[model samples]
Target: MFGDMMNMMGKLKETQKKVEETKKRLDSVLVDETSSDNKLKVTLTANRTIKSVEIDDELLEDKEQLKDYLILTLNKAIEKATKINEAELAATAKEGMPNIPGMDMFK
Candidate 1:
């Protein structure tokens, strides 16, 4: 029983190490998302910080349309960045445990 407990502790430590490494790797990643019409675009880091925003001259011709497009594109970029970050976190969680018992308690 003592040996088993020690082994479990060792495994948990290793998993924690891996999780930290994965987070560091994810921090260095950046995702770029562009609008479908290509009139607006945004770049975001995995941590969801906006790196840059770009708007085409054609889209700026109409003020109302330009505003709408900018909002739409920004939303899309944020959503994409959120999904990517979730995926990375989920992957790390999975690596820690395939299915954690009573995991709902944490939530």
Candidate 2:
């Protein structure tokens, strides 16, 4: 029983290390999404951190349109980031759940 416990502890430590490394990898992932017609652009990390935003100079003429386009583009970027994060979660979680069969993509 003690030996089993020791083995479990080692596996848990390895899992923890993998989790930390995956987090770092996810932090480094960046996705840039742009609105159609070049109205707005957003740069974000897979973890949904917005790195920057860009607006076309032409959009400055209309605050309302700019606002709408900005919101739309922001949502698009975050949506893409959310998908990436989900994939990352699946990949990361699979490390701890090796019995799952269809998680090969995550691996």
Candidate 1 clashes between residue pairs 3 or more apart in a chain or in different chains? none
Instruction: Mark the regions of model 1 whose C-alpha exceeds 4 Å error after superposition.
Output: 58-66, 98-107
Q: Which candidate wins on TM-score?
A: 2
List, residue by residue over 1-107, the lDDT tens digit for candidate 1. 68776776777677788778877776678878888888888887777788888899998789999888878887877787778888877777666652335664433
Candidate 2 residue pairs in clash (backbone atoms < 3 Å): none
TM-scores, each model vs. reference: 0.66, 0.80
The prediction achieving the highest lDDT against the true structure is 2
Clashes of each: 0, 0
For candidate 2, lDDT tens digit of each residue in 18-65?
877877887889999998897688898988999998889999999999
